[model samples]
Target: MDEKQIIEAVKEAKEKSKKRGFNQSLEIGINLKDVKLEGADKINTSIKLPNGRGRDIEVGVFAEGDLNMKAKKYSKHVLNKEEIEEYAKDRRKMKKFAGECYGLIAQPDLMSIIGKKWGIILGPRNKMPQIMPPNKDVKEYIKDLKNTVRVKSKKNPTIHVPVGTEDMEDQKLAENIQAVYTGIERTIPVEKIANIYCKTTMGPAVKIKW
Candidate 1:
């Protein structure tokens, strides 16, 4: 869904929550991978929140370069044009690529090299080389990324974040929940975002009036 729907959904959900005493604080999440990276700011920013969410998510990138440098580490098998075509036809290669990408990071420099050296090789399959900044606490964030709120709307656009939980402190939960709201707001823009609310993984949503 777009921005307006996002806000409305959140608000509706929050209202429902308050009606029921708002006792249940949910650890909400949203998927925003499909939201698109439209500019160069995300690549350069310390905190990359597509929807303008203020979260300092440090990513560990294993790409080609000085291993001790940033996270721009690399592997021998990036991809080729023919191989990309094969993967497109099979679709299984995507999974294979993902599997082989366990310790790999997408480097901006690699993308440039791929374009200059092997661009024609991987352009068609949309398998462009990418880069990620190294994470200080790679292990902790990686382990908890999926555990955060899992927002699923459409496409493979997945963004998991911690919103709230039943046991969370009121102010703390509210603060976290606001972060989620602002994050979504960043994506759709305030004008487009009509409203917002929250929903449990297996329960109804509550509207946030404030």
Candidate 2:
């Protein structure tokens, strides 16, 4: 969608979505056409929003020793080897923990162990932890992930991703939406996109003329 149309759509969507007791997230939905939702044809990737989603994105880091110390300093949740084992045993607790964080990053050395133990729980939900080199800076990675939104097409042809919160300016929200649209367009051809829609957490979807 053009900048003018996107701004107009965001304004209309914001107006339609009344303020709630809690801050509501603004989401963008895109429907696909002609693309077969099978195997590698599915859409699954992380896109960084230029204006962010207007919230603090909690990051969980899995590491040990010096790396663990660095990760703990920057991330809200840090899981050491022992803690990872503990979470592995308790599926319920692991699921709850995963739900609380926007994404997870792990020490590269622990990838195999994490995959073997918790892959079943996190993989299906697209919460699989990213691998980070032990020697690399943890703060930079956490900062980048804070501005990212996960977009994936699993069993459905349509995907919805949070662009920003209702509290953000209309222009900023429009820019965020455009960033998401461009990211998705990179994955799938423009002709494959059937429709695009925007909505708030509690509001009805409003179509965007792309």
Candidate 3:
């Protein structure tokens, strides 16, 4: 879709979406056609929204020693090897942790340990910690993850992801939607994109013409 069409769709969606007690999120849904989801090469990667989702993203970091101490300054939650095991034992805590954080980053050496303990809990939810290279800067990783939105097509031909919130400018929201669409197009064939829809958390989906 062109920029003008996306902006118009955003305006329509916002106008139709009445103001509720709480701020609603702006969502983008894309339905695909003639796409095979049988293999492992599924669309399951994160895309950084150009204008963000109009909110702060909580990030969890898994590290140890110096890296753990350094990560604590930038991450909302930082867990070491022992702390990870402790959290794994508490189902309630683990569940809350999984739901609360937007994404996670872990030291490369501790990935196996995290997988063995929290994999069952986080794997299905797509909250698995992104492996941070040993030599890379943790702060940079956290900053990038904060701006990212996950896009996954596990068993369905449709893709649904949040582009922005109701309070953001229509143009920014449109740009974010375009960024997501562009990212998906790079991975999946553009011809397979059957339909595109934009909506609010409590609003009706408005179709956008490509």
Candidate 4:
């Protein structure tokens, strides 16, 4: 798709949307053709928008020892080993916690327990915690995740993702949409994309013509 077309569609989408009390997130829906949501064909990955998500993204971290203390500075919810098991037993609490957190991170040591206990809940939602890389600062991963958005296709060929908020510049939102499009294109051919539409949280959709 042409970059100019994306920016134009974004501008039109915002113009059509009603102003809301809170900042509305800008979203794009990419409808694909002949793509199967199975095995390697499935779409499940993260893309870091060049322009960060306009709103604050709260990440829930699962860590212990020094990492746990370090995570405290970046995330509000840092679960230790015991706390990990605690939240696992209560389905209600785990669900609420998952809903509140935009992303999740975990220490490598806790993967086993987390997978055994919480995988069922977090797996399908794509909220499973990203394991922290060894010898790396937890802040780097958490910060990047805050600006990233997950694009997944479930039970449909259409992939929906939030590119940015309405408050962001049109050019920035367009670049984000392009980033997501490029990411999907890496898996599915561009010719396989049926249509691409851009819209705000409560706005009417505007189709992008290239």
As a TM-score, model 3 comes out at 0.91
- Residue-level lDDT for 134 in candidate 4: 88
Predicted structure 1: clash tally: 41
After TM-score superposition, the amount by which residue 20's alpha carbon in candidate 1 deviates from its true location, in angstroms, is: 19
- Rank order (by TM-score, best first): 4, 3, 2, 1
Cα-based lDDT at residue 65, candidate 2: 93
In angstroms, the error of model 1 at 55 is: 14
Q: What root-mean-square deviation over C-alphas does model 3 reach?
A: 1.8
lDDT of 2 at 37: 72
Which model is ahead, 1 or 4, in terms of lDDT?
4
lDDT tens string, model 3, 22-120?
889999999988878766337877898989888777899989999999998987688899999999898888889888888998988899988998998
Candidate 2 has an lDDT of 0.87
Q: Which ten residues in a row have the lowest lDDT in candidate 1?
A: 40-49
What's each prediction's TM-score? 0.39, 0.91, 0.91, 0.93
Residue runs of model 3 more than 4 Å from their true location after superposition: none
How well does model 4 score by local distance difference test? 0.89
Model 1 RMSD to the real structure?
Answer: 10.2
Residue by residue across 47-148, what tens digits does model 1's lDDT show?
222222223233233244354232222233444334444555554555455444322334444445445543443455444444444543334333343223
Q: Give the better candidate number (1 or 3) by TM-score.
A: 3
* Candidate 4 structure quality by residue, lDDT tens digits, 39-93: 5578877888888888888999999999999999988888999998999989998
lDDT of 2 by residue, 46-162 (tens): 899888879888999999998889887787799899999999999998898898888999988888889999999898878888888555688988988899988889778889999
Best by TM-score: 4
